[model samples]
Target chain A: MEKKFEIKDLITVGVFSALYSIVMFAVACLGFIPILMVFMPLLCPLVAAIPLMLYFSKIKHFGMITITGTLIGILMFIIGHPYPILIFCIGAGLLTEVVLKMGNYQSIKHCVAASAVFSLWFLGMVIAFFFSFRDAYFASILDGYGQEYVDAMKSYTPTWVFFAMIIMCLVGGTVGGLLGAKVLKKHFRKAGMA
Target chain B: MEIGVCSNKNGAFIKLDPRSKLLLLITISIIMIGARTVEVEGVLRLICAAIPLVLLLSIREYKASFIYLLLLGSALICEKHIAPYTHGICNIVLMMICGLITRFVAGYMMGWYTVKSTSVSEFITAMERMHCPSFISIPMSVMFRYFPTLSEEYKSINDAKRMRELGHPFSQPLTYIEYILVPLMMSTVRIADELSAASLSKGLSAGEKRTHICEVSIRPLDVFAITGTMVMFVLFLVY
Candidate 1:
């Protein structure tokens, strides 16, 4: 039988998108903490994996993950995030769907792997900061805030911080995926999503 | 249904088409993100600064608007001057705070305003007229409906957990997850199933053109809003 998403799958994706956006908004609010800001890229994917994986488990069809990711990207774009971020999110979602499909959407290992890949999409958040360290970026700031302020701001952000954020996202994704799998095994399975 | 944070209250914003509001949001975001010099940023800030004022004026929300304006004005001032004085960590922290205010807060506020003012039927009609594919329009329409229902569900779950004496989220992370996630997931599945059935029965998946009872036409306000924002955006880019 040809497998196309039914109306139910669409609704499921819609509901899941709203839930994901709300959770992400709460995470963004928490990121107001200066220290927590750096960790947010890491923590968001992990926290998000719970709902995400649950959604994934229930709908094991093709294109569902892509739909969710595209909706999220559009929502984020509508909320003023850069267009590039939307592209990045959709790409990550496509990869995640492929990974899950490869594992037949039934294997716990594949689910974890898919979750980890999906988490990497959060890397788009750091792109703005990363660009700010460049000479062109500095020139733009210099035009507005002058040399002294630009210098001060640049000095505050070390080059290593960018790399550190990337590393943290990977670590966070791995841990979050594992945690989501554990949750699925212990709780969601009993709840019938398994 | 309760409109949540985006309640309309018969504001002037509600008079404009949802498409116009969407266009305005896109223009402002592009300008804000692409802004390079302080002059451009300042102009963009000033433009965005008008949004809350308009919202407040339209809604007759004097107190809330006043507080919002006060906070916004102070943050702009701090971003321009106080940011230079603070050195090292303080400087970073202050800049982050200021950036948050200037860059994102406006966009979010505008988004909230649009959500509040535009009814779901109006939004769906606007999307359809824009030639959005059914795959997208169907899900987006459902997504809009999902938010209010989810809020209701969250409240009931909270009450149930409270009755069971489950610890608050702040007290026990693990137990909180166990209590909340399981029930939420289960209910979400059920809700999704029910919602799909209802929508399907309503001919949502018939692959036929759908019409709306919600009359959504571009008014003079929409034309002015879109044109005005576009002209301003072009002007900003020129200099």
Candidate 2:
């Protein structure tokens, strides 16, 4: 059987991509708060799950997540995010699509699991931070400020921060998926998104 | 909160073909990311960072350009004076803030410049000419159209919510979710349906060669920008 996507499917993906980018952008802005920076990655996927589930309920098609993810990645890349982050995002999207497909895109368990998988994309930001930004970031600071500053910075920033971020994102994704299911059942389903 | 979509601003960067602009975006991003702590490398990075500002100034976007310049300046100052004394967690937080500003801000500003300047028709035409597959191009074009429409809808929703005095976002979390997200989702679904129907009626998925009125040829400025970016990219690679 030859598979074809209708115009509606493409439009749905496009609209969802916009929604996803806007939400992510809003979350990114919230991350400017120094205190919130660590928590944002953890909380973002949960916040995003609501829309993702709603989008899935409407489409329930294979490859939709991949399409939406790729578009969001391109949008992020165009906006100034590093290329590795884009690659990670698309890879996570593909994984989420596969997870959802295995469950035939219907079960809530699969949806939540898929959201959890999707949230792993946040790891790319951390990876980018360490690989692309860390050394230069510290060096630029040391050069501009002094050695005392660099020493003080190194003492405060434990090496575990990145590992902790990954754990938090996974937890957030799980919680977000559950919340999205609850919302879908209580509101979106009644509102006709389902 | 105005969503910054492309405006019909006349600038040297805006005059270049979208494909060339894309190439510049890639090359500059690589150079910026690969930048080192060495004085010469840092200077090169600074010059690269100034490209967006110069382009914005050429378009007479004085206010926006100034704001961006201010951000860059502040990031430098903060790194010098404030970041060193902050303790463990505070130090990390401060470092991330500075990193966001210094490392990511230029690319972000460049992105804003690109998106705000290039019109949708021009983008679609360029993508088509580049022989990009329809799957990518169609969704991309639709996505471009979607942002402005979504922004418009958000404004209307915000006004309605304000009139009804829905609880503030921070104070009433569930209410905020229920009122704001639900309405937004419903409308989004409706809008998506309508847009798809409208586009289909116009033969968007006809799977035939399409004609566009937008002329998308590369100018000399594009050649110059692309050449400059390529040279810098090669330099970064060598050194």
Summarize candidate 1's per-residue lDDT along A53-89 as a digit string, tens digits.
7777876688888887888888878766666678878
- TM-score of the candidate numbered 1? 0.86
Candidate 1 falls in which docking quality class? medium
Worst 10 residues of 2 chain B by lDDT: B1-10
Residues B44-128, candidate 1, lDDT per residue (tens digit)?
Answer: 6577668646865675657766766777778778878888787766776677677667666667667656665677767878888
Ten-residue stretch with the least lDDT total in model 1 chain A: A140-149
TM-score of each: 0.86, 0.85
Candidate 2: misplaced stretches above 4 Å? A79-82, A129-166, B1-14, B81-95
Name the docking class for model 2: acceptable
Worst 10 residues of 1 chain B by lDDT: B4-13
Which tens-of-lDDT digit does each residue in B122-219 have in candidate 2? 88788988998767777887787677777788889888998999968889976876677777777888989898888789787887777766567888
Q: Name the regions of candidate 1 deviating beyond 4 angstroms.
A: A131-164, B2-14, B33-41, B56-67, B80-83, B148-182
Score residue B125 of candidate 2 by CA lDDT.
80
DockQ of each: 0.53, 0.44
